[model samples]
Target: MNRFGTVVIGGGQAGLVMGYHLKRRGEDFVILEGHPRIGDSWRRRYDSLRLFSPPRYASLPGLPIPVDDCPTRDEMGDYLEQYAAHFELPVRAGVRVTRVSRDAEGFRVETDEGEYLADQVIVAGGSHAVPQRPAFASELDPAIRQLHSLEYRNPEQLADGTVLVVGAANSGTDIALEAVKTHRTLLAGRHPGQVPVDIDSGRGRMMLPIVMFVFRHVLTRRTPMGRKALAEREGHGVTLVRNKLADLDAAGVVATSRIESVRDGQPVTAEGDILPDVGTVVWCTGSGPDHSFLDLPVFEGGRVRHERGVATGEPGLMFLGLEFQFAVASGTIQGLDRDARYLLRQLRQNTVRSASRPVTVDRR
Candidate 1:
């Protein structure tokens, strides 16, 4: 089996960042990507998809996003591809991790191509593992086109009809606003709220770093306010970015209460209003990480047993890019830099502890 000092799953931003740190420390590591190319994840997103963050906020540790303005999906993808090449990050593409399990020495990473052995493993796959939707979706009329936010590429994919976008999160808001350009759209859900100012405003620009600092340092698992906030926001969506309520209103997108059920194959909102003419249900509910392939007993209470990205129960196993793994920005590109450095420190501590243990020579 191909052995490495560390095996990093997912060659996206999080894994790439981890690899960068490992390379800096002169550690032997490999980044395994499921896709055929680096940044294909971003490339597969909707054509109109743009980052919620500015160019400055959207960057890896040492590399910056090569754009002055808000980057589009294609630009972000290209940047990631170039980053891997420039850093010479040891990445193996087209390798889908099937399972990761503990072994006698350390861990075994099973991929579609082959199995690899590593002294440590890091699962850096971000939260968007599976597109989440309601079970009632199968009950929707067969004629109606149903698409999750993850599968949605462009308005051209939709048939001619009114589109009902469920969930008012950032992706939902973006999709709802975009869908209105081509079809009569109705956004159904409780408003999760919006950013008070346009992201490009001077005040907004000034607040970006401050907010990131708060997310990174001020708010953490140790603080009371942070604890409350994390619990309250669990399963909730991100605050609106770029778009706002006025934009939706101006575009004639009807906002309504959450869909409670579907009666007679029609969507019935919590207000008892039946949406009968919605020919397309674009679900923007959200997604979660798929840890089913992980054979460790580390997942507890819907979270990996890790403190600041290091596995708590299992030694030599770590997780990266988990939402709020350390702070509010834990899974974001802006947060990767700090988290990577912290993880490296933890790894070094572990190495020292292992080495300090006295070796016993066996004589027969």
Candidate 2:
């Protein structure tokens, strides 16, 4: 029960697609998911969440998403569950991987329940596995309710007062728009920009194919534009897709500078003004790649050093579902299949290279 040919950590879209490829190859693999259900990750997001990508672009390798417009959070979750069930992928739920270390054979993946051994390991758990916040967050007054976007469900979760959203990214803007209906909302942080057209509109829908092409092909690791984008992708939010900064203004959601520090238990802005009336603070500051449990030397400056999805330093380790792993669409549902296939190919090459290499003899 503890042994596997391959251990795909995380049963989300990334892990699932990898599972599909491994299944086709008739490889004995097991997908380990921390959640009790397959799609609980999506279900745990904000209630008003809906994919910005339209249904045409939101599908797995074999199955199409059964909706015309963008799918809701619940729908996306359900779709993933359906995808797994339909494929009959071997997904073991509720198994949280605590640590992954190397052994003579391959990997020793220590989990909360027990140990698992595998020849190959795919850290497909995704980049946003942990919620991120500033260290100064603890200095805030205990009376103030705080929630990361991961934990934020809706405006109902906030206290009845001004809601200060700490990032002007897509998630921050979306939450601010929602909070404006019930609370005086302040959206703080500088946005990267906005998509020129309304994706939900007819004209936008017509242009969707072109945009998707750019994301999947034009702006990729192989392209100049994509390389430039990758350089700046760190610590910056993606351009606003559905909600624009203008929309926040129209809805009376106050846009402010980034929150600098906690002043007397209040949030002080970069411009020196202190927000005194914020009852709830939603930090959309963003999450990073959490591979702390990975007991490997493949990390460079805290990020896994990989060329595409292949771990440059490790022979049997691979990654999937990372943001901009190859292109801007690399983390999206539409891109998972491509990434998975590419990684599998890399895995095959690694196997071939390992098999052909001559063993070294030790001199006494």
Candidate 3:
């Protein structure tokens, strides 16, 4: 088996950032990608999709986005392609990591192409890989044309009749707005809190610093009410439907506290009301971590436990690009540079230590 100092899994933004850092440090590492081409994930997004933050916030190590305005998905994809080429980061394309295990010496990563042994492993695949759907949604009549937000390309793909959009996050809200233009649309779930894309007023400018401060200091999952409010406002960017919730009143497109179950091809609400005759259901629910391929005891309480992105319990096992992995912006392009730098430092330190240590041979 070929040996590497470090192997980064997933060639997305996180993985690329980590690769760039490794290259800068003159470290021996390889990036493993599952897709046929790099940055294909960004290209596959809906044509109208644009970055939530302005391009000023979208950058990687040693490179900056050309545009200050919000970049479209295609622009971001092209930028990533250029970044990869500019840095000449070593990437192995079309190699799917089937599993990762640890031996006495180091880590063994199994892929369809072959097996690779590395002293350190970094899992950089972000959260979007696993598109989550509601459990009750599975029993729905397959004829109803249910789809997750990840699969949705455009409103044209939706059915001809009325559609129910569940979960009002950014994707849900954006899809609902788009569907309303083509099909009769009903948006479910609580509305999200939002601010204008660009606040121009002096008061708005003053509030910007305060908002950032609050976002960084006060708003956190540990705070109960703050977390609830944040969850409710997860998809605040999607513009609200012009029609008021009271006007719909659960009739045209009803909102429920929660979906209880599905009966006879209809969605039953927690209030015992059934939404019947709906032609399509689009689940915009959130996703969960999928680490089935990892065979290490690294995760704790459904999340990978780490100190500064380095797995504490498992040495040489690291995770990059995890949401809030290190700081408030851990997973985003802006935040990944710093995280990658820190991880690269840890990897280099480990490599030096391993090389310096004496290897003893076993005597029979």
Q: Scored by CA lDDT, what does every candidate get?
A: 0.85, 0.87, 0.72
Deviation in Å, model 3, residue 203 alpha carbon:
8.5
Clashing pairs in 2: none
For each candidate in turn, the TM-score is 0.94, 0.94, 0.83
Report the C-alpha lDDT of model 3 over 1-364, residue by residue, as the tens digit: 7577788998888888888888887877889888888888788877677775555466776888887666788888888778888999888878999999988667899999988888889998856778777677888877788888777788777886778888765677667767776667777666654464343345555565555444444544446654665566443333432333443443344345556688887877778777766788888876555677888887777777888788877878888877656544565666687778777777755642267544332111
Tens digit of lDDT per residue, candidate 1, span 93-124?
A: 99999999976646889999988877788888
What is the TM-score of candidate 1? 0.94
Residue ranges of candidate 3 with Cα displaced over 4 Å? 196-257, 348-353, 356-364
Q: Whose lDDT is greatest here? A: 2
Model 2 lDDT tens row, 46-80: 99998998877878888888998899999999999
Error of 3 at 162 (Å): 1.1
